[model samples]
Target: METDNKESIIDYQYKALKDGKSIRLLYLHTSSSYHQLPIEVSLCEFPIDACPSFGALSYAWSIDDDPAPSDRELLCDGASIKITKNCEAALKRLRRPKQDQILWVDAVCINQADLEERSLQVRLMRQIYTQASWVALWVGDASTAVDEESGLPLSDLGMDFIHDFAVEIAERTNSGQALNEGPLYQEFIKDRRAFQYSESEVFAPRVRGVWDVFHRNWWKRLWVIQEVALATDPTLLCGLKAETFHNLKIVIKALIRSEQPVDVMEFNSLFIAHTFHQFHVRHMIETGTMGKISPPGIKALDILNATRNTQASDPRDKIYGILGFFGPPATDTENIFPDPDYTKPAAELYADVSRAIILNTKNLDVLSSCYGFFKSTVPDLPSWVASWNDTPVQYFDGKIFNAAGSSTVVYEDCGDKLLMRIKGRHVDSVKLAGQIPDSIGYSNEACIELWRYWWKFASTLDSYPTGETVTDVFKDTLCWGSHLDYSRQQLGENKESFNAWLEILTGTDDTDIAAKRIFNDGEPFKYAHRATSVTWGRNMSITNKGYLAMVPIITKADDKIVIFQGSKLPFIVRTEDGTSKLGGPCYVRGMMDGEFATEEDAGAMDELEWFTLK
Candidate 1:
């Protein structure tokens, strides 16, 4: 009359004459049907193999769950859970005949709020599930259950501990198997006997299809592994891995689960986790350390970490190699950029151009590669605001974010097999355009040098959290990725000092409202700024002053001052502006000073006569 899969018992029934080989499922007729048990049968008469028992009967799921563990007690629902009369009836149908029974379940005993305790239990999983008397597999949706009831009936269990349809596993000794000594502990060996609660299709013992219920949180991934160590092959656990057969199950299963699994912060650091590569080679770099991952992100990091160490000696060595660019271990300077808190909602861009050439391992490249590296390393800012622009904004970590005025980066998108035009960052426009060609003849040393310089800049993304200054970016221990000839690369005697920025924007004084509006497509672009100068008319004309013509004028408000031809801008130089003034500084003051010259009327005055007005 009944089959083993009581959860689906109502879907298809046995004919008493012919039987199916699979676990026959019992389903309820109406979705409104609450929990109920099969007709009474004594413990002595409990058939062992493939027969339905009170525990296997389909019933309504009770709202009340298992007790919270000590660790999660704080997260417990105060122990008062609502249960419908339907579930009480189901419980009466399964209770032991006037006897006591111990139940083991994480939801009821452990505290969900205690993160530390929960984390430990999650790490120690093998000892949890296998030690129980019997594990109750609750397949939530009745429509998703499978059915099979062919083999001779002889199955077991003593308690009517099914509070509604959910199984109340009886507690027992801790007898789960242990794992081999390793750096990190994994879950139970799927083949072990202790967890042979379900009949596996291809392998030996199997757990139920759905082993653990979901509790959304990054810390819970560990708990999920701990709680349900076994699962029947017929059902799927995570949405991503349920349909696949590959045993590279850890990442896939965790990815399959609908939640964040690991501490994203670890990814922000450039690591050497080359599981698929040689352990000693430089290989991986994870970007950003906050929030969750989607299907795309999970797969990308998996591939990156998997291939990190193919060369060997410790992939970390490669990271050290990358650090070579910041220059000799030196003193710290104030960083000009802002430190972006990765924990907030923003995007992260990571690129690994640590590719090897015939002899050089440096990442020197053309604009295409430069843009790729720049975009990849930039934290996930809005794409619309990314790309090349006329004027640049300061990156949080302060590399120049502007692109050149009239150039774009070009690339071939293999998907369309067509060429595309994209813009470059300001530095890219200045450093990568037409310089580093696609060839490696090594002749374009200028561009090559710039490429290496940019790589040095990119590596600093790894150090952004510390608010380290840009001058010290390449100097940090984590900044270098390859070797360099520092002697030749030593930026000459002078460098962009901290005070230069102070004068650049504020001028000599603080009241100048003088600023230029940078436009893109004739519209104000987000976060754009103009380069202000700080020149003085005398020897002080170094892009920092207002020209008074009589003596020298130091700017008070804006740094760059304009020598206007009476109310209009006459001459303005951009910061570090190399453009020479087309004409000499002149005073148009004689008439403006109201001192009219009515004396010189001689036609074709000679050079001496011209000097008279001067």
Candidate 2:
């Protein structure tokens, strides 16, 4: 087909994927123009068994507007069609100057206006990217030349550090040295004085710059996870520079090892750094690059939990986006994968996914993610499933060590609905719930003051007459094996250990004179700093029966703390108007093991009920 008095272009038509059919991809013709390039879009069918070679585009859409027409236009089948500036730029950068590039640019390839076609195309997203010869990650336009002072563009100086760091890591990897053995580590050991005294002067600014790049919106997108993870070969595009995913992994690994000087940076930067660290670690595990240490296979719930912070335009994509990583569906009995349908509401989608995971895995561990319902705007969701569409509940697992231990939860069918069946005893009901206190300021003096306050509080609490010492009970309440164990190692087994735990909580231990003069710097202040920051947001509550527990910040008085059978930690639940709401998970004293289920505690058990969480 041709337009009147215009150059003839390949006319692409939309064809749905039939039972034994292939997907049609947009073949973008090459363009040489640097400005206002008119892309030529043609349709090419890629068979399931013999897919044509193509490069897929992975990108975050522009925030200024929807997929509206811009001044630039693309020639689609001899007809002019307006394209977004973002798409225009992506096409210009992706298109080769001399050769035709067969690409699967989702915006152009799928008839997005047609809801049915969009749903069909989304289901095949995994195939589109995985089958492609390469995947180009468009991180906006190319960056300008590296700046002389910081050796990177001022706006993205962190990229330069990351790139340099990645190069060093690649060198070490190629030389057969472990990734942990590198110049960064050597410098860290050899130049302790420089890092200790000149941290702000030398490393603070550089670290901040690198962190800025990671906080970019592209890193937090939900869909890119599947896009990049499923690709055969992925290339990262930043401005004009190009880097492979392998090199990017190296940079991430290097950053994970290079301890950031948290004392000098802002709290948000520290949090972001920690988040990126976890993100990279999870990515490594998921992509099977973490070697034998990786899990046998990741559960869909785990993926959703790990990437819950990742943003998605449609909430349902939060689950749908990561489906590719779980591998294809198995038999009819194992078909837990939720079909991609844009028509479903976010709550319905979340509920269905939760149900499938529970029925297929036959475990209630998925419900372990449930937390108190503060206030949800999403309509028609049971209190059981988390608001997967909303902002993720910030559960500070880093502070509580034993939180990672395995737990067994069985699922049961209760007449018309599903229910989690577990064994355990009720601990206490919340009597007083306190809001998270104001942050202990970031300064050294402020941290020390906070430490002193906590120390005094601990001493006073220890003086109280109780069966178990206040310190022991409090440590157990925090689920000690993780963060508390580290504190115990730092502080001796005596009274000093109690003070050491306080110091760890306040981020003030390293500031001591004795520790400052020696090479043995106390744990990186960031750990304590994060612990303190996270503590500020947690709800401190006293049980009606005089028990103390730290629940999620959203928890309120009347929430019941129950140690469910097989759960590693206790959970908080709130019952109102004949409906029970799960208040997420928590750690309680004497509940880590099955101690609560023992016959000795039989009399302490509150009544057990078949609680149905809708």
Candidate 2 lDDT, 214-243, residue by residue in tens:
545566677787787777668877565566
Global CA lDDT of candidate 1, please? 0.22
Candidate 2 local Cα displacement, residue 404, angstroms: 15
- Structural similarity to truth (TM-score) of each candidate: 0.19, 0.75
lDDT of 1 by residue, 1-614 (tens): 22244242221111221211112222211211222223221111111243342122222233223322222111111122222333333333333544423333333222334443333333222333333333333312211223244221111100011111121111111233221211111221233233323343322111122222121111111122212222112122121122211222232222223232222211211111211121111112112321233322222223223232222122222222122111122321211111212232222212111111100211111111112112322344222222121112111111111111111112222232111112111110011111222333322222223323333433334333225443343221111111111111121211232123222333432222211212121121111111111011211111111112111122122222222111111111112342211111111111112122122223311111100000
Q: Which candidate has the highest TM-score of all?
A: 2
Model 1 regions more than 4 Å off = 1-102, 113-120, 144-614
Report lDDT per candidate.
0.22, 0.57
RMSD of 2: 6.6
